[model samples]
Target: MNVTTILLIFLLGAVLTYVSGNKLASKIALGFSIMAALASFYLLQLYLANQNISFNGVWLQSPKVFLSLQADGISLAMVLLTTCLMPVIVLSSFGNIYNNAKSFYSLVLFMAFAMTGTFLATDGLVYYVFWELALIPIYFIALIWGNGSIESRKKAILKFFIYTLAGSLFMLIAFAYLYTKTGSFLWNDLVKLNLTSTEQTWIFLAFFLAYAIKIPIIPFHTWQAKVYQKAPTVGTMLLSGIMLKMGLYSVIRWQLPLAPLAAKTYMPYVLALSIAGVIYGSIVALKQKDLKKLLAYSSLAHVGLIAAGCYTLTQDGLSGAIAQMIAHGFVIVGLFFAAEVIYRRYDSYKIKDLGGIRSQTPKFSSLFLLLVLASVALPGTYNFVGEFTVLFSLYQINIWYAVFGGTTIILGAYYMLKMFQNVMLGETNTKAFADVNWTETFVFVVIIAFLLLYGLYPKPITDLVTPSVKEILTIINR
Candidate 1:
């Protein structure tokens, strides 16, 4: 009934999952995630009905940073995303034999706890704590359970850890500066500061460095390809599906409103960079022969458009970003799970080593192609709604900008279809590629159902988040 209930569910579930012996750990975690997700949905229903579902308490009295958590329409949307995806992500691991199943599933639940907290925390200091708290479990997850040679895995993990932590330092410094001006770490106080243009510009850049690295926009994305390739499928899912949105969501909630003038001032250059990432990621995806790496670049392309939409600073643009974030979360999890399926059957992830899977595993091929179409933003799929709205918002800004941003559709189709043909539609590989089992089928069914259902009628989600989006816009315009 309260926001704290959701966080408590995940946190307590994490401990209980660890304690539950290896034989039942995965199931326990999966059950916990499903319960939490269902609970979060009910809470979102209450929030939309204008009922208050919040928790506020003092953790520190001197400076008065409260252990406050609350949900308006926007935070619930993100919380729903984190909750919904955790169950699916946990479900995907049911067949695999992890070395330390208890620890692995426990970290998965713990990460969910931190992410939900990040989405719900209204106090700036509490939000930052959850933000940095997320990095801990994922770092170990990748380092301990990830696939690759020790040297390669260590290098990738270290680079990712150092890169992201460095970004957090800048965010912390910006928060410290803002606290001096307002004497409080509440979001309400920060947005109300009458900062001069110089202060706004500097603070904007500070937050920009933090979020951009997390979102992994073009120039800052050096860590993405390597990390994604080296990580296990679950780690990749966490990084791509939910964690990346943390950055995009932060921009809407914190960066833009707190530094409105600078946000407007720097949007042009930022849009150009974001659009550049769209092009860059697509072009690179075309050349990638490794399945995981190809999807990595593809993710980069799609997320670039999401980032560009955020900078468009329009109602259509911001709402479209949220839709795309949720849509992308599901589609990417499906795609990565598909890749894992291919690997398990064929023992290889290289495109050259894969062919004619469709001939043998017709069921998987059918589902995968649908997911591929969704990724390319085909109409009647959820991504199409988000992508079209985003480009339309850019068109309102400038026709040339829209034209450039729109290349993702064509380029995405080219690379996605090309990968599909090369891997799924050749002469049958001289090896077995069995169709997906029941659990895998269940995973794909859940993902596809969400896409099609929302694709047919997106009004519910759009209506739910619009008020919150407008409130952020109102603060920015002030």
Candidate 2:
């Protein structure tokens, strides 16, 4: 019925998931995820009818802290993305998991709850708490159930935890500064404060450090490959698919609007860094032998383009970034799932060790190919629409920038096709390999269907995001 009611339900689901046994854990998680999705859909409908919703009260008057939850078009869209993807992620994990299934499912549900809170909280302190809170369950999930040797998993998880936490500390400092300026933690209060240029610049830099590490612009990206490589596929899916977006979302929601002059003055360099990340990530991906590592680099490249779009500071760029965020979320999940399918059958993700999978698993091959094409931004897929919008917006900023960003399409095709050819097109291996079962097929097919549906008729999503994008631009231009 309301934000708190829905969040409580997810919290309850998390508790239930933890207590449940392995046999029923997945089913319980899935059921709760489905309910969360339905509740989010209802919330979206209500927001469309009413425009906005908020719940505000003094939680600690002495410190000027408030318990505030608000939903706007932007927050609602992200909420919808979180709710929509959780069920799919839960379903995808069904066959792959066994031991500690209850803990696994509980972590997943807990992640959903944290992500929703991050999206909805309107107070800066509340938002930061949710932001950091979201990371704990994922760190453990990756550390406990990840693919590599125990030491490797531990190393990867530690790197991930440290990198994100280090960035967040700077963000915490920025929020503290803002609290001093406004004497309040409320989002509106902070936004209305007339901050000096020097103050805005410093705050922007602090926020940038946090979000850059999360969006993981090039030099800061060393932790990502190892983490993605070691984490279980479900954990990888949530990290890349949902968690990364939180950084980009914050950049839009907090950085650009709150520090408009700083954003304008520093955007060119930021855009250049993003462009560098695009090229660097693609080049690095071309050399990766491990499938998970390759996808990890590719994810970095894709998000770099989205970050570039955000810095372009145009409506089309912002909207396109949102579109690409959604597109990449689905495409990366499917790509990782495809990798998981091969890994399950062959017990190897090394490109050299796999070949001629298509001969044994035509269905799996077809699905993998489609997802790969989507990753490479083929027409008639969701990624194409997002890429096109982003590139178009970049062109308005600078033709060379657009040209550099466009090279991702070429490099992407080279690496993804190379991967497909190496894995699927050679003579059948003498070693035995199994095709994906009905469950995997169902999961892959659903993702593919949504990809195509959005590709062909992206207007609905564009329409949903447009008003918010315009609102953001209004703030920037004001």
The reply for model 2, stretches above 4 Å from the true place, is 51-53
Error of 2 at 134 (Å): 0.8
lDDT (10s digit) by residue, model 2, range 436-464: 88888888988899899999999988888
What is candidate 2's local distance difference test score? 0.89
Minimum summed lDDT over a 10-residue window in model 1 is located at 61-70
Separate clash counts for every candidate? 0, 0
Cα error, candidate 2, residue 297 (Å): 0.4
Residue lDDT tens for model 1, 1-478: 7998888899999999999979899999999999999899899878877888998888888677988897877788899989999989999998688988899999989998998899988888899999998999898888888888878989998998899999989988999899888888888888999899999999999999989999989799999998888888999999999999999999999999999999999999999999999999999999998999999999999999999999999999999999999999999999999999998888788999999888887899999999999999989989999999999999999888789889999999999999999999978899888779999999999999999989889999999899999999999898
Work out the TM-score per prediction. Answer: 0.99, 0.98
Q: Name the best candidate (by TM-score).
A: 1
